[model samples]
Target chain A: MLSIKNISKIYKGSNKGISNLSLELHQGDICAFIGANGAGKTTTIKSIVGIHPFDKGEVTLFGTNLQANPAHFKSMIGYSPDTPALYPNMTGKAYLELIASLYEIDEGERNKNLAYLLKELTFETAVHELISSYSHGMKQRLVLISLLMHNPKLIILDEPFVGLDPNATRFLIDEMKSRASEGVIILYSTHVLEVAEKVCNKLVIFHKGEVVVNDTMEHILQKASLDEIFRDVTSDD
Target chain B: MTKLTLLFLFRLQNQLQLANLNSSNKDVRRHAFYTISGYIVAFLMFLGYVLFISIDLNIDNNIQAFFVLISSILFWAFGIWDILSGPDDLIKSKDRDFIFSLPLKTWQAKLLPLFSKYLIHIGLTFIVLMFGYLVTIAYIDHFFLAILFVLVLSLIIPLLSTNVTFLLAWVVRHVLSIIKWRNHVTESIITLGLFVAPLIYLIRSSASVDYKEWFIQASILRYPLNEINSFSFMQHIILLIGITAVTTSLVILLLTAFHHLVSSQNAVQSKKRRTNAIWHTHIPVTALLLKEFKLYFSSLTYVSNTILTPVAMIALNICILVGVIPNLHSFSYDVAGFTITAQHLFTFIMFTCVMLTTTTSCSLSFEGRRIWIMLTAPVSLIKIAASKMAVNILLFLPGIVLTAVVYAAIFQVRMLDLITIVALLFFSLLLISIVGFFINLHFPSYTWNNDMEVVKQSKATIITAIISMITIPAIIAVVYTGNLYLLLLIMGIEIAAIIVLLQKISCNNMMLN
Candidate 1:
């Protein structure tokens, strides 16, 4: 559902950001994007979501070139950043409602999705409180809820499981698997190999700014475990 | 002493790194330039005050006292604010956790971070007040003593103010807790008391009397500068030492008490939850505008500080219109003994109204890291910019209208002139808001940890100030020429230009590094 082709974002006076990075994900695919620190995982995600303008190459969402129709492209994708980059003073429900309105999600659908998600994520009571007062896990759950509120076809979550407690983490894993089963494209970056091995059917490994591996998890883990493979792949040249 | 020295050096190294970032990064450099321009404007204002005192008023004693008193009060007010918010930086900092995990003494670990964060505030105050002192002092030459007094007073002011603030807070909290009152009630009462005291006084006394005179008289009781020249050298030394000793000891005692009080009160009063019922509105711009207002109003510090100048301007205009203070010679320029007319005074007010409505200028920066949501949302950037502009206009409209109405009634302006005045001020506000929004788009700083940095200290605000310096004069010229057709032409062209600029900024690139 999403295609990133030869995209390179070079920070001025530095050789740090992504370089000639490319990725593709289709429906019913949970692509686990694994990388070490500064491996251009976030840069690539940001570039694809149109947050950081790439210096080179094109990104297409559901056959629509992002530059040609950015509005349509953005509407079809749900991006949940690593940090809960939300208005601190806003209530969780207000933020979700805002996201719903922006994505043109109808009131009935928004309410149904919100109720289910709040209960499932165990943040039903906390939704009325200010987001500023929420714990890290609560904020992560809220961000995830906002991401799912729009029912976007493609979901891009960066380090989505960082602050989730064990219960929430299990729920998130189950939800991703369920969404993937329902033919939604899930692209998530994480350092947690065990979760990725268990939940993600496809694995894409990034070293430096370039993708080193893009194949099924079974194929990548044929000889070694996910952790050993990740260590071997990201080790020094 | 050794730990403090090492910690101070580490703090200094971080400051140097920040300075380097400001110089090396283009975006940071631009922001630094704007912030420095703000400082330059403030310094020039101080210079103007000095010139007014030296040349216009030509009164030394009262004016000197006035300057000292205003500065000290301002210092104390900030000190109190810092103390109320200080514990957050002290007890709740992630850095504190990391430092505590290291090998450090109790006081060293606790006080070093607090000092590193707050001492800059005191030091900057010292430098600015020293400049004010140098300009105001006309007595016998004691440069060394003057410097010493400024330094000593700067230290004493924060120490004394923080001590008093916490003692009062502790007392209020204890008293309220005993009486079955919530902690927020105490906070609200304290905040209300602090804000309303000056407001009530200003309303009652400022309209009828020269506000400077009131400040000059009050200075005698509040500031030590008023009494510095009266004492002999030995007496001055003794007084300084005595004040320092008392303030320092009080601070030490208060710090211990503050720690205990905080430890005892683990259950902070959480505000009642707000209802988050979704009101599905068809208009996206309205949603964005409401969001802007929500964010703006939720920050008490942002609203109070940004609104203070505009509120004071309105009050001054009222004082003038009512013939209470007779006339406004304070802001008027005496060029070749020709006192400018009230029209020029109205121009000054318009200029101030445009300048003080900073809601639009820093709104983008205020988005901080959350800007990603806007960038990735299906909503157009024009809608975002328009929402910000609308909020700015709505915020300044009531005050501008009230002030303009009073001026019109007092000046006996005809309907045509009143309409002209209102139209002109509204157009100026639109133009300034656009200019500020554009500058922010170019030099946005989203890395700020504090809202104050984005709202007040960003490069966008300074750039807006510089643009105002140009726009205000052009506006004055338009009014000074008094051609109705030309005024219409200018306003029309400005609206068109604003539309085009908004379109260009949105279409090209909305985010800056």
Candidate 2:
């Protein structure tokens, strides 16, 4: 289980971050965080993944406090940022290998997982080329491969579908579903409400750095479509 | 304003970092202050040195011609590297595509970079000519004529030099294009040659040239005074016109070439195919170290800038051993009644060179936008720091050990002295590495458009260099008593204190963001 209790993060010299955010996810849960731009979706995800320290909060992954043992907390989680900021000088294979080494995965196991993921994602030929040469979609696929190769308990993705093609996006959704079925928790932020409404079991909608809606997808969708609910909740008037 | 003028102003503002001067953040303002102050102080010092040299030379007349010759030679000697390495700036600017897409004429687009290059040459030429004018006004009776001569020469010199440099760069690029090699490989070879050529010239010339005679002969005021005096106004005008014609022709050629080059497709070479897909695993630190090494070697700018000092130190040691240079053993200095030999000087030089080789200073900044990789990795900051320091140490260790062996072999020193020298050097390396990493953590820059900005101009690198500049001479002066054991003990204690302090800082500041 992953739990974030009352996390508040305000960027220095600015009041533009999440405030008093709380969320909990048990095993086999797939939660979607939907928000408008600058609505604190990335900030909350970053805070939970230990990328940014919250002003006040406690994040525990599998009973390990993030502040107390960051390395252990981070080891149990896989994160992929929105922009896919990878080393351009490194080849795709080398970058994935680096991630494997960081997570202390066995060489044989890493290779096996990578081979399967590469084929599934249809990036086998491009894996040998430098990341500098990869298109946006290819780089996104590489990041996805790196995130899944470690088999972490909690997976957090920020806008993972931004540059992906339709086929890759489908593959990602299926992969998330398969992983969640195997007792892994998945949390992702997205602007695509249609996709989020279809794949997620739980929904959290943020507006102006505060959570406006937090409930099960089955309960929230009974009243209106996700598009209608998102527009209605996030409207300034 | 016209679009071209707006573009130029934008580029200038970005290059000068003018926005930082007005930044709301106090730290940004302070950093801008320091950077601007550092440049002003360096420029004034250089101007002062030139004025002193001119006064010391004490020429009576023909000062304008004499200084012109000196300035011409200086420009050719130093300007070659700028020209050879400057094409990258023109063609590889981050905004090249964005700017090219705008509604601008082809001539305007070509003129922008040429104008920038010309401005740099003008700055160099102005400094040299300003001193010449000062000397001429003081010495010559025809003051207004001298002023006219200096003004005309300054304008003509930069124009001619800029055109010549661009022409040469065009030729080199065309040749390289024909060869069709990788850009990085070609750049590395050229950068290395630029560094090594001067060292080779110095070594080869030290034996053949007589210092006093060459200086006297080269200064036209001292030799062939009659011919210098006879260099009249008509001759100067003819020379200027000839240069202007040549420069105009070269500018036309340069514009044509720029248009062609910009239109041509950039060839992308495929990397060599790998036979196997398996990757070997290692401990985290070892993997980090291997990654650091690969990064250091991949960029020409990083390798050339950080590796030159160590390479020079090693080369100096070899030269001394081979008798290419005079033995330092005979030179001695007395400080507070204690005699310091050239061996101490050698040690000081080695320490200074090692101090300049702090790759850790910019290693973190070089990660730039990719710092997310390191920040998100399941490793402690201390371990990442250690890996960076390890790469730094490994880069200079072989040179340090080779110098130790050569020093001992030459001096036939006692075992105690050998131990003290080795310890002092090793401690100095550790001290610089830790301090560099600490400074980087405090002032990291992750938003740079060019690698040179982070590697050469970032706050971390500049601050570390300033610290080294102060620490090296201060340490040498304090330990002028020629007490080797005392130096070793002092350095060891300093290193220990720094390690403790870094530990404290790291506890409070673990995340780079």
Candidate 3:
């Protein structure tokens, strides 16, 4: 359960980001936050995660205000950046172990998740190698593993499937569903419409930093195809 | 008179800082600024020798001046060219191949940089010399002609070197594909040029105090610039022009050769990874450091930065202290158990080790994009910071101790001073390591396009190092002025301050560092 109330970010000394946008989510909800590049999706997500400050909005995780208690909220959420910002010098296992240690996961849960993620990602062999030597796809998988290490309640992913292989992509979609079914809320964002249309339970199309649509998949689909709606929303630009 | 394609070469020199840097490392728009600032700072620091040395009709007294000035320019020129062009030269995009596939000739693209380089070179130096000659000095026999000669000399040197380096880049880029000795050879050349030059020149010049004995090989610059016949200024200008014309012609030839050797179809084939000599050191942080170490070590830029650069600087100093320090070569070894070299070396070694802790300062900031993983993880913020601190201590401790011990063995360090040096060194590292982390944490500029930008250009790191370096000496001064009990009190105050600062910084680090 994540809630954003009137969230707006104005970068200092520069006029940027959206204004007065808000959203609320619940567990098992697969919300697709759709926007083109620079449509304030990142700004909203960052505000929720306490990475950047917002000028006119409040973000709360499980009824705890992010501003009032950031560390508490942060521990309960998993955020994946659009960019794979990995420590090039760190090995896959070293990185995973670092995440595990930080989350303060006990040895058993840490081992189980590390093993499961590495196995699922087909990275068991390569996880011992330094992340710098890994290709783009491998880095993406590692970030996913780091995000999933703690199994936080709400998952916020920014363009998670950008560089993944088709098999990895399939595994990701299935994993999101399974995780959601187990009562973890998923907030997946992408520019691609088809993936969002097929997987997301609730679709929220963002245009000009305001929510243009938010409903169950069938309700959003009743108006138009996801592609048609995306065109309509972006056509105003 | 036909125009020889001169664009007031001296004017270009005035605009050198036009390529100045913007302070923000994250923004790529300011790269032109970053690069040019680096170039100008490095270039101007070198030209200090030029300003110090008088260049007159008497070239003998100015021989040291000439050597220092010309070599400074060449050193900076090579550094700048390498800094500016190396990266673009390394990467050949699919689009570049496509462009080359078109009717456009390779010389058109390659020759443009060379021509512009001549403008830049003349622009870089000639104007300053001209200002000195025209505004400041009125002793010129032929002011106009002297300016012309300076212009020619300026153009010729950079033109000659840029073309040669471009040719070398093609060769090194290609040769590296087959054989990998390019780095070794290049480094050897730089080492000889920067460090061994004075020794070589001293020996050669000292042997030939009488010019007639070495008439054909009196000086490298004299042979190159023909400043020998300075009685007639026009002849001097003509010779300078002649050299430029010849060198330009040679560059054209080299460019033609480059066009042939570098085929249009060529792409930088991914290099085969080296496997011959793997490091087998079993260490805790080994896996984490191996990738960064390999990335930094294998690449010339990083290798020079992290290890080779400092070691090379130390080696250069060793040669200077051993060969040419004013009185060290013939100095006394015992003065209450202190050698002349030993005192300076102890202070120097301690300064260097504490400074060495700075190697880890930017390591975290370098992980700009990936910092979120550390932030979101269950690992306490302190552990993450400690891992980085450990790497820095890992960077600082051994080298410091080893060098101190080596110097101790070589010199008569009284046990008291040795203890002092050891205490100072450890405290210095402790102070440096903590401040280094806090600097990066508090003002972490993680989003840097250039590795040099993170290490060298980070303001936080530089300021922190300066403050800590200053603080240690200031504390020592205050402590030494008082009794041992007072020294203990001061150390207590420092430790208390550090702990408080650490608490405050670590508390805020989740946001800042």
Candidate 4:
């Protein structure tokens, strides 16, 4: 279970990034955070990932205060940034190993998980090659493999499917489904309402740094499609 | 084939122009100007020195110097070529992907730029050399004949320099193909020396060159003033023309083979070759350390900067020893100590250089936005810092040792002094590692795209290194004599103890965010 209380992020600038907000998320839930460009989705995610600190918020992850043991909290949550930063010179395997080593994966288990993940993702011998040579889609597949199947409390990503081809996207969608079956909380941010409608169990519509609605798909949809719901909530802002 | 080389060369010129304007690697642009400007100033200085020296020869040094300066101006005219062509000619840049898949031959792409850039490089440097000759021409009685001979000499000099540079690198590249151990050994040595060229040169220039003791000198160009202009011009020209043509042919053949070599290097990166063997087990910290090391070493730019320069130091020694760079400026052989040998002096230079090059000073800057990865990864920040520190030490050790051996040989020092020097260098290295850690920690430039900025502009690194260099000799002097060794031991303990103190400070800093 994840709970956010009194999460008020007032970004006072030409374009504010976040404002007073509150929400709760739980396992076996795929929460789609939908917002337009310059909306608070990325900023909110950045704060959660500790990439950027929030102005004011007390986040509690699985009953532990996020700040009390930030590293431990982070280690239990796998994050894939909008543009995944892979060491260009590192091979797919090498990059994965670096992450795995940090997550403190055991040798035998790491090998097994890596093999299974790579196979599922259809990564070839190119896994051993330098990522400097990898295509954009290949880089995403590697990051996806890094995030999944670790029993992480939360899986957070920003536009996880931006560069992926159709086949890779389908494979990724299927992987996310299986990951969710294991009671993992998946928090992904995207601007595509259709994608959010299809993959997400819960929907959080944010505009001008405030969450207009965050509830189950049907409840938030309220006799209307996500696109209509999005238009209604975001139009005034 | 030459026609193709010319066409390919023109395209490279265009590409180079783009690189100068657009290279994300900013130093590539700056270094191009620096090399050119350094030549210009150094040339002017050289002319001034030559003019002063010529006065004793009863020659009108001013006229000679003025002519020499003009010759230098003519040389700088080639800077148009270099600035137009840029370092992008030599380096593989961001645009290679678009160019690589094109219908062009690989040799056409690679050799044209390599050949053209050097052509310009020689032009720039040779102009300076010609300025010296022009000054001498003004003093000579046969001014017309001197001018005529000098023109021929000037053209041949750049041609000769370009041909020699191409041939030397070609030979080294080929020899590397055949001699595996030698290539690695040589590369390591050059990488080590890159850390200390100025220091090595300062030490060497300060020391007296011993002509009778052949092994006693690291510079082959000893007494450059004695023979800078004395070589038979016509005879050398005839000889040089022959050498240039022959070398040009060999280089063309080498260019033909370069395609295969680059493809092989690419295959290793692109085809997913097997990694070097890894141990079956590793602690988390060790694993992270290995990853950081791998990241640095595998990078094309970093590897070139780190390993290639030190390994190439052998050639530098040869150049110095052979008097390749004409002594236009007054120089000395005074290094750390007058008693220091060429080999030991070489070591000290590499030691300082490697310390300079290892670049723990900017590891934080290198992190960029990805610093959160370190913060989030659950690894101890100190371990990350330690691994960075360890990588630098391990990488520099081989090159430093090579320089020390060479220095020991040149100085004819006993084993004891060598041992003492090693101990002193070792402590100095330790002190630098600790201080470098704090320098980086105190003021990390997270936005730097260039290692040069990180290495050069990091105020802490510059200030600390300057301070260290001044204090090192004095510390060694004291440490060698009395209870200073105990003091050093005490100092090491204190530094180790300070890690705790620093951790508290860092924790507070981390809290501020």
User: What is the DockQ for all candidates, taken in turn?
Assistant: 0.56, 0.59, 0.27, 0.42
lDDT for each residue of candidate 4 in B134-205, tens digit (9 for 90 to 100): 655545665565556555545654554444443443344345555543232343333334323433565557
Give me candidate 2's TM-score against the actual structure.
0.88
Q: What share of the true interface contacts does each candidate keep?
A: 0.51, 0.53, 0.21, 0.49
lDDT of 3 by residue, A1-237 (tens): 688888887665345677888788898999998877777788777766766667777888788887776667777888888888776655677666656555556667767777788788998877777676788889899888878878889999988998999988998999999999999999988887888888888988777777777788888899889888878887776
Give the Cα lDDT of each candidate. Answer: 0.70, 0.74, 0.60, 0.59
Over B1-513, each residue of candidate 1 has an lDDT whose tens digit, in order, gives 686677677655444334534465665665555565566678678656645654433453445353456454554455546533523344334355666676877666666655665576567557666666766577425567777776766665555555445445555555665665643423434543553455456546654445554444433134444455664634755664576567656545545445555534423433645565644534577678878887766554456445554555566667767777554444555658756676576666666666556667788888888898898888877788888888777867776777677656666667786777678678778877888888888878787865567766777776676677766777777776668887788778778877887777678656443
TM-score of chain B of each: 0.72, 0.81, 0.63, 0.56
Name the better of 2 and 4 by TM-score.
2
RMSD in angstroms, all models? 5.1, 4.0, 7.4, 8.5
Compared with the true structure, what per-residue lDDT tens digits does model 3 show for residues B397-503? 55556545644654556666556555655665666667777777766765555555566666555666567667756664543343455555555665676687668
Instruction: Give the lowest summed-lDDT range of ten residues in model 3 chain A.
Output: A97-106
* Residue B21, candidate 4: C-alpha displacement in angstroms: 13
Return the TM-score for candidate 1, rounded to 2 decimals: 0.82
TM-score of chain A of each: 0.97, 0.98, 0.96, 0.93
TM-score (chain B) of candidate 2: 0.81
Q: Residue by residue across A10-93, what tens digits does model 2's lDDT show?
A: 887567999999999999999999989999999998888777778998999889999998889888888889988788777888
Which ranges of candidate 1 are over 4 A from the true structure?
A221-228, B12-215, B220-255, B259-269, B274-283, B313-339, B342-344
